[model samples]
Target: MTDPNKSLWTATARPAESDETSHETLHGTHRTDVVIIGAGFTGLTAALKLAEGGAKAIVLDSVEPGFGASGRNGGQVIPGLKYDPDQVDQMFGEASTDFIGRAADTVFELIDKYRIDCSPVRQGWIQPTIKQAHLPTLKRRLLQWQNRGCNAEWLDADRMQKLTGSPCFVGGWIDYRAGSLHPLNFVQGLARAATDAGVTISSQSEATSLQRNGDNWIVKTAAGAEIIASQAVIATNGYSGSLLPKLRATIVPANSFQIASEPLSESQLNEILPTRAVVSDTRRLANYFRISPDNRLMLGGRGTFSEPASLKDYGKMMADRRMLFPQFPDLKVDYAWSGRIAMNREHLPHIHQPMPGLTMALGFNGRGVAMGCSIGGAIGEHLLDSRVRLPLPFSEMKPLPLHAWHPFYATLAIWYYRLRDQLEN
Candidate 1:
């Protein structure tokens, strides 16, 4: 099996690449107080917070900022995680639960502080029911969340049909805590802010080697620059693999895809999603889609590693779009692409100390937006504060078994999911 070449997120939304790419190249060695790898959400957030806390940050990436999932996402700042609140509460202790709940409450806090304007639409999120089997479970989940002081509302079938413009959904709930954004623009804004704050950010430069040197940590880059900082952070997430030792085993790289449609006519757009709430269904392997600010239907779901050429499955995306929405089943196809996320075994964020002065953070399990920002900022404080207070959920860094069976096991599990999706109600 090979990595999926076809991904939808890559095709439609894009960052202002020329802005970051055309900058001068790195030729000589440089130094800074902090060096951040992988200019995605996590790295940029860390850089910004580090700079804010009176530390100089040097950020390096294999590509420009927002070149990865940070820019290519469907732009939904949906609240919470793939897991329900109760599940999250159970996974972590009560204090951890409170910490996570408070953490999510601060997503917009960073946005407001940084003045990020990626077309933020804090209009909340919904999970439309594609079948009846999940109605009860979803309803229970809704009440569970509501009981916890959450602003969640379970709509009746009539409301859901009217809101979704389709009778296919039996019913669904809306969590008012979430919203959407042009992720690329949001990430770009973060990068711009970090740069302005004196963070020395360099694109197209990769961290080639990392080692310990007594009281300092040394980082060598492909551009030949060596950074000796009092502390080091491995914020590369999934991409941190190989370049940073034991980084790959801490998480699983799940392949995710997305597709976007050409903007619909005004009438058709209103006919489809008038309220413009983001949506994902209850399927184990599910389809998550939302109407863009310009009225395009952006849909994402499915994992891929091969036959990637088929990811341009615009036809399939449209079929499902029409099947559920039906109003604009005929919407014109436009963009398609995919990317990878670091999914942890526990489906929670992980942070650990690879060495005394070094730290590792990864595995948002797909909640990169809020969790990434929270982790980045919090970990920045952790490093600056000498790791006195841990910021992430997992206390220890447990590497995924690097046995030869990993890829095989992952592929088998994905295949099993493909089969299970068919059998899932």
Candidate 2:
């Protein structure tokens, strides 16, 4: 059954929601220097950067820019991968070490220079230790980041509880460079800015197929709209679809849900997250949250059994939120939505040169906001100068071995975690 809520994109034509209803061209053929697929961050970033470099990039989105996860995420601007800095360095050879290290810092720098006003707040990030044994891993990661010139400081258990106003965490670490944003607004701003920078963007233009012609590639839409270009960058990531099969195997699209509560009183806000810091417990299956601008707690989690029915059902998400903050156990949730994230089994981002004249940037594993922004620029520069180095040591690898296992594994995993969360934590 087709999802009716999925068509909501057709109406939301804002920069935040993939609005470009004004430029929806039907039954037309166009040509450009480069054609990009998927208007989420990757596609938008590629378009913006390529256009600024004097390349005519025709950005085609099946829906609209920020229509997908790019617009509906937790708005976190986290610095690095889900791995320790040293472990990340060892994944790729020594030659890519410095590049990966620099990338951890550059993601935030891109967000700053763009002046993206998605309610960005530099309140820092806290990775609260989920188990007592996890404290060693946290300490090891901190030292690793410090060795790589990252400004990370380990917080004791007392300090962690005091800062968070919750006794759920054993210890944590603070990366001062990390922050958060209003996701939809941020994506909208990026699309608008890139369009203003000379990138021709088209919404409602779903890419149906891609084929290489002599020296260029042709991007065709279901409506028969065509764009021919010398180069193509598939930034579809989690939504790569048939445009690339390898992406489907290597990047699995997983969903996470978020619920935002009605604003709290001044006293209530201070008692909840006084410092305004974004927090996430250190778990393979994790819960992430932060205080919204209006003082509502925006909480995100992974184990959603069903698509919530209404706003009232969204409020029930607070029951899960209370697992961390007992203070706001009965918080009134105002809005709720879910977004899909692309996770590489390896948990590292990839830059793929799948075929000649094609490059793919994908797999942020829920950290796509900052990762996508920086990768867009990195890919644009590389397209401009082939010798340009990226922060990640990436290569094109075959897609997942058994694709059908994803949905089943996803369901079973969620069920297992719910049981574990009930019994253990």
Candidate 3:
């Protein structure tokens, strides 16, 4: 497997190497108001909120915090869900559109409150379309969001070409609520903030088992440590495994691969993505790309189901970048990495309560960064007060049929989508 630490973000982000020592392994029995498994964005954000509310919370991760998708994402903090505003209204009610539209606000708010230095750039996110047939959908999407008071703007072919410095897109839209950041730094900052607020986070401490004991839940760690708490949260998104077989069966972990080009020259940068806006496109398996703080062209898209083995695994991504910006100077691949995305059939973030005093949320599709923090904070609030409404509705867990053969099914699906995308062009 490719070392995740080899990624460009990890090499440049904050939370110095010495800071890893702060997350000690859990070795003793402890008591807290709540115990959370998987110290990624969701777990850390929830713990931070609970601690701020004067509740004792303990977070345990098999590896260190930010070792999962939280630190490995493309860092484009786009707001809203997979559906557009009108679809959100028809499916989840009108109120949901407003909340979902501003989901990125939570990310920026948290960054500002904690003073996280994650190279935040609110230049906006562009969704350009290479397929002309998709223009009507983009039009409706823009109109609906604008009607809801969102800062969404339409981009004609000329405007799109001017902004992206590419003539491939016929048209697109830009959502000003979106932005990019150093993902590793943002998650590490969350850890620091959560610890400052009195949340106990343990690294290399896996929750081996959980059993109900009277009114509390007893969680045993791999290192023979124990934690008894009144509430428990399963915040392990794409990394959730055999520890909870049923939960793992509810979603497919799709791998996303990314490659970073060598830092671009000032002239090259000006000729490509001159506005520095993060971009994605209108395709079944969309390609997302951004300009890194160090000026590297970071492009990403879906990958094989398994962990990547070498740079060749990202060959398609590198080719895509070159095709998008052929005017660039010599482009060299400096980094290649992959992260799993939790995808469910519904294509929405799902919250579930399978048992008493236990809450679980996962399946953010490709929008985990903003949704994870927003939904996590809401989960924390709901746990503190039942009357507090959640941004998403809780549904019963329905494990996908033939879950074990998901790899085969996902591969076939990817092939179909790839063919469809090609045919559309």
Specify the highest-TM-score model's number: 3
Residue 18, model 2: Cα distance from true site in angstroms: 16
Candidate 3 global TM-score: 0.97
In model 3, where do residues sit more than 4 Å from their true spots?
1-5, 15-21
What local distance difference test score does each model get? 0.71, 0.74, 0.90
- lDDT of candidate 2 over 64-93, digit per residue (tens): 777778877777777777777666667765
**Candidate 2: misplaced stretches above 4 Å?**
1-23, 93-108, 305-316, 416-425
* Per-residue alpha-carbon lDDT of candidate 3 for residues 259-373, written as tens digits (9 for 90 to 100): 8888888887887789899999989988999899999888999999978888877878877877777776358888899898999999999999988899999999989999999
Candidate 3 local lDDT, residue 317 = 88
Evaluated with lDDT, which candidate comes out highest?
3
Per-model clash counts, in order, read 7, 5, 0
CA deviation > 4 Å runs, candidate 1? 1-25, 102-105, 310-316, 386-388, 402-408
Question: Cα miss at 107, model 1 (Å)?
Answer: 3.3
